[model samples]
Target: MRHTEREPDYIIKNDNALINLENSVKSLCKHVMLRQENEHLKDLVIDRNKYETILGNSTPVMKVLRLIQKVEKSNIMVLVTGQSGTGKELVAKSIHYNSPRARKPFVTVNMGAIPEDLIESELFGHEKGAFTDARDRRIGKFEEANEGTIFLDEIGEMDLMLQTKLLRVLQEKEVTRIGSNKSIKLDVRVIAATNKNLAQEVKEGKFREDLFYRLQGFLIHLPPLFERGDDVVLLSKSFLTDFCKENRMGNITLSKEAVKFLMDYKWPGNVRELKAVIERAAIMSENLTIQPEDLIFANG
Candidate 1:
């Protein structure tokens, strides 16, 4: 959770700690954590540095920040929806790092990347000899995140069978590892993110309606970078400055023409893409000044 997202290609890591602190503090007082140590948790999360890395003045961004403040304190399931590279995981990390569970393990599992047959074991662990490859007992992500938070990314890709098991686990607040009858209790906060339109997926029978509704205890939708107006300029300068300082390069500035060029293009890849382009431009430019000609989109 050092920077903007799970995507490390472009996220500057310096300010994310502050951002997490700021965003996480706003919500700690809003909800009573379902724990005996609510007061301790509050003390653990709140800090002096309040401003987090989320930089935007646009109404849409402001609304998202306000919602983060409202939802950060509770243990309710959170669903973050947006296009890929829109910083869904960033939002998820902001909540976890700024919450009472900041010191606990923050385990992340990418549902879409795991093979369907193995994901269940990856999430809930497996007893020794549970499967041919289960040579030893394994601790799953959920168990590892006990008393902390588990971020399930690309949840829309989880198959129906696993979805059923996951729903049961969420409902019971416990997990039974494969080949084991004993269920292990957990106190993990759940945060899930997806780029797919889950409503549409539920309609198509690809996603479970019950699970969809269950994940919607609090929903946050991240707008694509293109829709955030001048945040692009703010972000551009920030990234420019950080990249220069990080590399020990002399001060670098984006020419006015380069800024105009950034504002004009529709960033289909969102914040992640913008950061990559700027970092690349910073390196590819000949001098401290970055002009329009220095800009280059990686895939475009």
Candidate 2:
């Protein structure tokens, strides 16, 4: 039956070939145009105050800013410890963009998101035919980030076996693929972040002590939003302005009631949750200003 169908319907087959040729020509032209446009696209126009754009004059943010300044000139590994939404990644970006390697790639990997079975392969890559799914060779984050910096978020969530592999990479400055016998030298700097207490995890044997020490070359701790005082109101205003511009709404300011509510609320999700609350208010508010009723939190 399949062989009979393989004998092409002569009339329809010629028409199909002609149509495919025309489609191929059109696709080629479209691809060429896109390539030209991409080539003309200007390089990233990064704002100078990108970090400030996220966090305002809060003491917690100031502390992070100071740490970033102190460590930008060094190649030491940095460990940022904080709650989930406490802006650890922002600190990582600020350090990378302000550092000597700013021009190079800034790669981020969420260790907690990768599967336990593939974490090592995902970080160090695998050679072709290394395992069941290894149909093709892969270049891992460590390789992709060579000569640049790699941000490993939620490092505390990595499995004990992978922690040992990571420790080997840090110590040897090299990586060997899962199936490859040869080790490739690496010059990448690593920045790690986690919400868990590594000291406790070390005593529990969940994390390696040596890896924790290596990752803590320059340790930074970020305070939660509740402890940041007046920055709450300041950040609300900033987020309000940004939301207004993004949604093309007329400029709207926060009311006194709204400001007080923001200041009093205990932000469980930190600055991230704060930004979302303001954006929600900006979208849902019908009045010229964001009133306390317009804020969408349980307390607001």
Candidate 3:
């Protein structure tokens, strides 16, 4: 007796069969929105071409640009170690803008600004009834920067308890609200900066070593303004050009002596201090040139 059971032919040669195959293929392709692989975890990379246009071209600044370029495409966590007024935030912004996440939110949370009692709620957020004052659901910085970058300024100042929670988030890529048991997934690129010596803090038992290592995937230590050589002068010029235009002061140029004064003095506040000096001088000097005396410092 002949067997009647049979298997269906997988090959399609008829018009209806061909049309069905094409439609299936098209449907699959539509679902696969392939994104080009990021060579470095860095979604954003710095554009050196705009370096001079934005900041300046001194050796120190160039070195900063190189570091930015090197880490621009990498997704590794960045720890910007620098002194106050050293433009740490600026570097953080540069990294974010240059990376692929440039289009996403670049949120900055000043650890020092937030009250110690409320820092937890501000950072990790809380659900209603989490605490006495938490009357409604709150979204924290990590949640706000879910798919973008979060620049945590003064990370060293974060409380020990909060640091533990932050460490958990870094490890699991998820966050739990104050009162919620559910964990929310995160894709944030954390860029933390501090003026403190984290190594020292770790040794002192203040900062968590594990968390430090996690955030220190890539480190960028900014040199002080005085050590940056002629970057002071370069920054001065850029500041002068912008300030004059900003205040409509009829464009003023820094005299040779003025440049010398700025170079010789110690900028304790770094670039921010230098910019303030330039602005004061530009406003004081009515002539086309800014003289040395136009810069008024107690010691200098």
**Which one wins on lDDT?**
1
lDDT of each: 0.87, 0.85, 0.83
What is the TM-score (0 to 1) of candidate 2? 0.83
All candidates: TM-score: 0.82, 0.83, 0.81
Q: Which predicted model would earn the best TM-score?
A: 2
Model 3 quality (TM-score): 0.81
Q: Give per-residue CA lDDT, model 1, range 26-100, as digits (tens).
A: 666455454537657644553321234677888889999888888788888999999988888878888887777
Evaluated at residue 105, the lDDT of candidate 1 is 71
Against the hidden true structure, what lDDT does model 2 obtain?
0.85
Greater TM-score among 1 and 2 belongs to 2
Model 3 gets an lDDT of 0.83
Q: How would you encode candidate 3's per-residue C-alpha lDDT over 107-143 as one tens digit per residue?
A: 9999989999898888889999999999999999999
Off by over 4 Å in 2: 1-54, 298-300
Q: How many backbone clashes does candidate 1 have?
A: 2
Model 2 over residues 182-263: C-alpha lDDT tens digits? 9999989889999999999999999888888888789999888999999999888888887788888989888888889889
In model 1, state the lDDT of residue 7: 55
Candidate 1 regions with alpha-carbon error over 4 angstroms = 1-52
